[model samples]
Target: MRLEKQQITAGFIKQKTIEKGAALCGIAPIERFINAPHGFHPTDILPQCRSVIVFASPFPISTLSCNTNSPYTFVRNKMVEKTDQISFLLAVELEQEGILAVPIPCAEPYDYWDESRNHGRGILSLKHSAHLAGLGNLGKNTLLVNRTYGNMIWLGAVLVSAELEGDSIDMETLCPSGCTLCLDKCPQHALDGKTIDQKLCREKSISCTPGGGWVLSCNICRKICPANRVIKQNL
Candidate 1:
């Protein structure tokens, strides 16, 4: 009966997340992320964490086609905001169901930062959590390449006390080997084969506040990725 209860809880959460604008949702056991940074682990946020519920919302590829910065910027912000709202709502619903839950933010760096290196890490790596939940895989560009949405997705997560059945890890590789478009197209050469030079990436991709909102200055890596193009074409 405990397993049945967990199953019902997970189903309810997934359905509610979709109704709240998530395009995809999945669950993973906390143990699946044992190798994550100590502070980013589910238990660190909520000591009773037993499962991780991850979700994603797709960004409209058509928005990038416009020359106006407003389209891409607006869609980007909307996607992240929607994902965050879904997670927060799910967390509240889980608590009402008698399960303790903690919602993770879709953006902002919180867990770790190295001042000398000028590098920051997220409290929970949403991309990796989404992958572990079987929503996507890491592409060569280091973005989470969702099977249906490619790299064009916003991710969020919630930690819960229910031990729900977790999704299986995706085994099929999504990136086309030998393709280095993202690396070659990077304006600052921030991408290496396996990792990004965070300092260079930030300098090229992020613009500081002028009036209020920050800007995503450059997006060549996302634009040039073949997988993203494929998704766009199919859509």
Candidate 2:
């Protein structure tokens, strides 16, 4: 925790993140962390803390292809496990450095009867936080789309007692140009110009997903986008 200009080094973890298969990483103050989607509704004042470290690990493109048609829970659990493992390791490393850390994708399961069950959905929003935290911008499909990963990434963060002055960068994401194709491609019309309706999207996909796959909805948005498709062809 050196203190000079910016309280933390922006590129330190950024370098490690690449080797660890992280597509992107960034740091923000605990105050800003609480204000993020991961924090859900933040407290009036952030408690004694330093910064929030964010990381994004790319999910396998094939993982997105699998469906309930497989009739096995192994793949589903594997996806969740891999994501939580990445987040857990980051938190552990922070603790080893004598920092108080909280990992996203918390190990706790939400209770169906508990009112706060809805609150736990903020984990999904953590993807949005990581996106704005310099990982990438939210594509039209509402998934965080990176140059290397298209709607195929997991996000996690750590809260520490170290703040980096001037490290808080502006979340200025450049929207893809003339990319309303995803919006128009939505069969359920869940994506409007401003906000998305998850309920409608999920319901509409039920027809395509048999034996209980529609609960999560389809990703036609990413499949139709030209961003990564162009990169793939060039490669």
Off by over 4 Å in 1: 1-7, 208-213
Pick the lDDT winner: 1
Which digits, one per residue and each the tens of the lDDT, describe model 2 over residues 66-176? Answer: 554242233435556765776677667656655555666632453222243222254325555555455666766666666666555566665555554324453544346
- How many residue pairs clash (N, CA or C atoms closer than 3 angstroms) in each of the candidate models, in the order given? 0, 6
lDDT of 1 by residue, 203-235 (tens): 877775667877777788887777776677776
TM-score of each: 0.91, 0.70
Once fitted onto the true fold, the runs of candidate 2 whose alpha carbons sit more than 4 angstroms away are: 1-21, 31-46, 62-77, 106-120, 165-174, 205-217
